[model samples]
Target chain A: MADDIKILAFDVFGTVVDWHRSIMDEVRSMHLDVDADQFALAWRAGYMPAMQKVMSGELGWTLIDDLHRMILDDLLVRFGVTQLSEEQKRHLNKAWHRLGAWPDTVAGLRRLKQRYTICTLSNGNIGLLTNMAKQAGLPWDCVLSAEVFQKYKPDPATYLGVAKIFDVEPGQVMLVAAHQDDLAHARACGLKTAYIERPLEYGASQVKDVSPHPDNTFHARDLEQLAGLLRC
Target chain B: MADDIKILAFDVFGTVVDWHRSIMDEVRSMHLDVDADQFALAWRAGYMPAMQKVMSGELGWTLIDDLHRMILDDLLVRFGVTQLSEEQKRHLNKAWHRLGAWPDTVAGLRRLKQRYTICTLSNGNIGLLTNMAKQAGLPWDCVLSAEVFQKYKPDPATYLGVAKIFDVEPGQVMLVAAHQDDLAHARACGLKTAYIERPLEYGASQVKDVSPHPDNTFHARDLEQLAGLLRC
Candidate 1:
């Protein structure tokens, strides 16, 4: 069944790149008078709820860039940090574009590219993905995004849109992600699913659930493991 | 000034790749009992009118793959060619993905990529552009399409949308193309424009209008010349 997948749509934030560490490192470099790890968690904690606003029709179509800014503004106040100027706030908001790829990401993706069409299916806007790809040497055949569909992930359209764009059936495309919930949603939309474990996605302090879900077509410890399992 | 441009969005069909020769070669290789060059011309002549249908809302959104197929069907009948099988038709429709770039395309593009965010701003759909990039080794940072905007070339939205996606001012994005009208439209949208001369775009049987347009920001015989002018 894995061999039948023609395109592999990857979830970017945790699966292919380490957003938490990247964001925390950026904050640490700035020497903010706050717990960096906790700040990173606090910022990411708003991602889902922020997307939910658009998904649930509470907000009009919005890019993750806008949502990131909104969350950053609130987090700055909650962390008792001095207010950043417009230029500083803008630079901080673009931190998403500079996230470092996981160690296995580039090599694993290169291997997978030998067989299947690999691209990002992230909530990150096109600018973010393009810049990240350039910075991290991610060899994506294309950079797809939730912005393309004007719908965030977990929405059926986001998964189905990949198939539609590639002119392939849902079953012929696979969604590779670190989150079991993301795989479940892809599976619900009839896409093949692969879950990659990222234990330290949030931080080194908390234990993450890397348990496999029965519905997924493939699950592995990371993209490297996934590539090996796929016989890439 | 040319020095201000950060993103070089390309017009793919003629500027970068020799589409007429490619389509002619693909058609001739089939050994159809028809003039291949004439067939290629007839087929391409239908391109704008077909796109105009969608632009005028006479048709719903459609991919260039489908548009090309529609044009091919009419051309086959008009040229007194027998109908091809479903598989044959599908294979022929994908010839757009196999277009060979001009002599200087790769070297010039590599040079330009060093200084700018290089991407496709073509009328070709994503699948076609992605596959073409893979086939011809066109190293695009991302592939932008009229399909993404659901509007064809000369549409201001298509040009401005490139700026919006990259979060850059229109002046910072240059539209590089072989067509004067395309460059003129980009200029109208406030995008800097570089016009490349593809004298054989329509075929060597007739002279093409490669005359410089006063509104164009730069003019070159090919991408290599453009890169030289930009000092990339």
Candidate 2:
């Protein structure tokens, strides 16, 4: 069994908030003349490639807020919806801030917070995470971000930064993420890793293969299950 | 009127937690043969000079935790209490982490958090702030520290760092502190300032002549009053 973990750093987009459904709902509410699900998927599709540019040193440090805006601008043109004013586009880009939490998010976080310090170690910028926490009622002890280190997730700096913030060895901090790649990177940095199965993170029609993999220290179906497994 | 402050960055020591009383209580609990109040005051008197060393570039950036330890060592000798082992000294030095919040702190913070994104802009390092928040049930949206900025409080970078973290303009963020110097420094950096008077911050019988000088945008008796003044 793992020793007592002092800190639990979470991935925000899928694990804490249901980004897929929330983005789709926002697209639908905007009454944009396009497939909301497709729009959501297309926008998310731009995420990894954008981070790869920075990760590969092809681009200088860029925050998730700016990247989100860039993707939103391209997405608006791709969806053939040019009626949005600059102000409206700005507001639309902030949809990430208003994303709803997953069903298990609040209760699980509350339980986990009882036993350990919980924080967000997401690729999301600090501003975005802070706003999301306020909007979604997620009880984070701190909203740490890649923005603090000027690097994105899967980078050693971002993973190690969490440990540094809490002044603990990396082994004492656990990364709770939905993505295998993120957990893998954190594990490589000597941090404990938990893989949370956000099966429908892509959308309902796209059923994810939720088969267990052996790379992580803990695996759970949702935040609630993760909390239970952590004995919180 | 202040233009819809979204983030409230608080000063921690005397604002959120009663450090004087907490330290005195801890010293008393240890049954140390010394005046608890005097011991507490002596330890706190070391705080400013230590922070000034970093602020004035005399000392390379040092965290409050380490500063506290340095002062703790001298204080032990000054009080002629050499009975504590090294491990015991270390544990006792971390009393700052377990400080009890003022009566209205938790409830007021909860209320403020309903409307504004609340965080700690403390000279305390992230580790100390995180542990203190966990112990005291202070529901912070994030814990921004001087450690993050690599500069202590009253520094423009530390004050502006809070604004930068939230990607908001300085004027849109408010610094809630009990100290006049801290508020003045924040105001100089264009951040809104609120002074919460903690009359007995030092100790009840010590006769602290706290002047209600009008240097800040708002002044209140305590966190509860501050919450009401902010209409949170």
Q: What share of the true interface contacts does each candidate keep?
A: 0.68, 0.90
Candidate 1 lDDT by residue in tens digits, B1-232: 8778989999999899988999999998887888888888888899999989988999898889899999988888888878688888888889998999999999999999888989999999998888888788888889899877878888999999999999999999999998888888899889999999989898888669889988888999988889999999
The regions of model 1 sitting more than 4 angstroms off are none
Residue A194's lDDT in candidate 2: 90
| TM-scores vs. true structure, each candidate | 0.97, 0.95
lDDT for each residue of candidate 2 in B4-98, tens digit (9 for 90 to 100): 68789999999889999999999999999999999999999999998888889888978788899999999999999989988889888999999
Model 2, TM vs. native: 0.95
**lDDT tens per residue, model 1, A66-103:** 99999999999999989567888788888999999999
Interface RMSD of 2: 1.4
Judged by DockQ cut-offs, is candidate 1 incorrect, acceptable, medium or high? high
**DockQ of each candidate's interface versus the true one?**
0.81, 0.74
Residue-wise lDDT of candidate 2 within A158-207, one digit each (tens)? 89998887778999999998888888899999999898888899898897
C-alpha lDDT of residue B141 in model 1: 89
